[model samples]
Target: MRILITAGGTSEKIDDVRAITNHSSGKLGKAIAEAFSAEGATIDYITTKQALHPDNDEATIHLIESTADLAAKLNELMTAHRYTAVIHSMAVSDFTPESSVTIEDLQDTIAAKPDDLALALKEKVRERTEKKISSDTDHLVIVLKKNPKVIQQIKQLQPETILVGFKLLVDVPMIQLLDVAKASMEKNDADFILANDLAEISGEKHHGYLINRHHKVKEAQTKSEIAQLIKQEVLKLEEAK
Candidate 1:
C-alpha cells in the first residue's frame, strides 16, 4: 500500500535563531516507516531536520519546520496523490510565538497592573523586527497563539485514506488517555488512534494502545511491536474497506 507518514516535532520560531519545540526524537516514526518499507509499500516521510528517519532509499523525504509549514506540505501532497494510508506521528506544537518584547518596553502597561497579562502583553509587545531578540533585557515576555489541528485536516482532505492518529499524554491513567484518544479519533475522523503515555515509554519498553473505529483496542509494547500491530491492522483495515 502507498502511505504517508509525519514524524518529529514542529519548531515555532521565536526569532531567526530561537525557537520553541518539543523533544520528539522521531524514533518510533522511523521504526513504523521502516516496517512498512519491509512490506514493499511506497511511502513518503515528512519530518523535521532534527528527527530520526528511515535508511531506505525508496522513501521520499519532505522536511518541514513549523506546524503551518507541515499543514501546507500535507495539503499539497494529499491533493496531488491518492495515498492509501496516512500515519500522523508527529508531535506538532500547539502554540506559536505571536509576539516578543522586553519588560522594559512594556513598563507602563505592567505598572498599571492589567488583569489579563497575555492580552496586555499582546496589545503592547512590539512586533519582532530583528533576526535575534536583544539580550539586553533581564526579563522578556513572549506571547503565543494556538495553532490549527493539522491532523484533523488530513481526513477532511482525503477521507478515503486510512488515517492513523497518535495521542501522547504525560502521566495520565490509561483509562483517561484512551478516553481522550477516542474523542480525538471521532473528532478527527481517524480510522485508528495510537494512545501512549510518556511515563510508560522508556527505551525499548514503549507501550501503546491502538484504538480502532469500533472502539476495539490492541495493546502493543515497544516501537517495533506497535509497527507490527499497525501493519497487521492495516491489512484488516483494507479488507473492511
Candidate 2:
C-alpha cells in the first residue's frame, strides 16, 4: 500500500524574524509513518521539521515550511503518484498571516526623525527606543487566513482513496464528540475519522475512536496502535476495490 502522511505544525510568520507556531512535537505522525513502513507500505511524509523516513531510499520525504507550501506539495505528489491512502496527521495551523514586516522597516521609520544629538544621548535614545520598540512588537498584528482543508482536497483529487482525518476534542460530551466527528468526516469526505481526547492523549499514551464510513466506531489506544487500525481498514478497502 502507498500511504501519504503529514506531520508537524506550520509556523506562521509574524515578522521577518518572528513567527506564530504551536507546540506540536510531531511524535504521533512519526510513529504512524514508522509503523506503516514496518508493514512494508511505501510512505510519503510531508512535514515542517527536518524529517527522516523509515527507509530513506524506499520512502519519499518532503520538508515543508508553511501550510501553503504543504498544500502545494501534497497536490503535486498526489497528482504524480497513485496513493492507496492519505492520512491527515499533521497539527496544521488553521490561521496564518498574509504577509510579514521587518524590524529594519520599523527602525527606519523611528530613526527618520530630524534630530541630531551627542553620541552619549544617541546611544541612550537608541537603546531606550529599541527597548520600547521591542516591547511594542506584540502590537504588530497580522490578519490570518485559514488554511485549505487538506482532507477535502485529497478526497476531491482521488474519490476512491481511503482518507483518514484526526480530530482532537476537549471536554466535549460523547454525543457531541460523535456529532463533530461525523460532521468532520462528511465535510472532509474521509473514510475514517480518528477522534481523540486531546487532554488524555499526550506523549506516549492515547485513547480515541475510529469512526468509519458506515459510522461504525472502534476504540484506539496509542499512536502506533491507531496506525495499525488505520492500516487494516485501508487494506480492507483496497481489497474491496
Candidate 3:
C-alpha cells in the first residue's frame, strides 16, 4: 500500500525573519512512517523543515516550511500520484498574517519631525502600493487572518483516499476532547481522527485516542504506542476496503 503522511508544525511568516509556528516535533508522524515502511509500504513523508524526521531508506521525505507550502505540495502530489491513504499529522496554523507592514513603513509614518511625518506617511502609503516593503526598520505590525481549512479539502481532492486527521487540545477535559475530535472527523470527512491533549503529552505518559466514525477504537499511552496503533488502524482500513 502507498501512504502519504504529513508531520510537523507549519509556520506563517510575520516578516522576512519572523514567523509563527506551533510546537510539534513530528515524532509521532515519523514513527508511523517508519512502522509502515517496515511493513514494505511505500511512504511519502511530507514534513516541516523544523521537524525531526527519520533516516529510513524506505521512505521518501519532502520538507515544507509554511502552510501554503504544505497545501501546494499536497495538491500537487494528490494530483500526480494515487495513494491508498493519507495521514495528516501536521499542525497547520489556523491564522496567517493578513498583511505585513515593514518597519520602514512604520518609521516613515511616525517620523519624529511632525511636518515631515505627514508627508512621509503619505509617500510611504503610495510607495507601499508600488513596491515591496523593506524590513530594515525597528518595528512592524502584522495583521492576522484566518487560513483556509486545509484538512477539509482532502476528501474533495481525493475522494477514494482514506483520510486520517489529528486534533490537539491543550488542557481540556476528556469529554470535551472527544467531542471536538468527533466533530473534526465529521467535518473533515476523515476515516479516523487522533485526539491528543497537551497537558497529558507534557507529562511522562503521553495519552491519545484513535476515533473512527463508530467510536474511539484505540487508546495509546505513549508516542511509540500511538505510532503502532496508527499502523494497525491503517491496516484495518485497508482490510475493510
Report the number of the highest-TM-score candidate: 1
lDDT of 1: 0.89
Per lDDT, the best of the predicted structures is 1
Tens-digit lDDT string for candidate 1 (167-218) = 9999998899999999999899999999999999998889999999999999
Alpha-carbon shift of residue 187 in model 3 (angstroms):
0.6
Clashes counted in candidate 1 amount to 0
lDDT of 3 by residue, 61-168 (tens): 899988888889999888988888899999999998655566665554666665754345545555565345565767766557788898977888999998989999
Off by over 4 Å in 1: 110-131
Ranking by TM-score: 1, 3, 2
Q: Which pairs of residues collide in model 3? A: none
Angstrom error of the Cα, residue 57, model 3: value is 0.5
CA-RMSD of model 1: 2.2
lDDT of each: 0.89, 0.74, 0.83
The residue pairs that clash in candidate 2, if any, are none
Candidate 2, residue 225: how far the Cα is off, in Å? 1.3
Per-residue lDDT value at 206 in model 2: 81
| Candidate 1 residue 97 C-alpha distance from true site, Å | 0.3
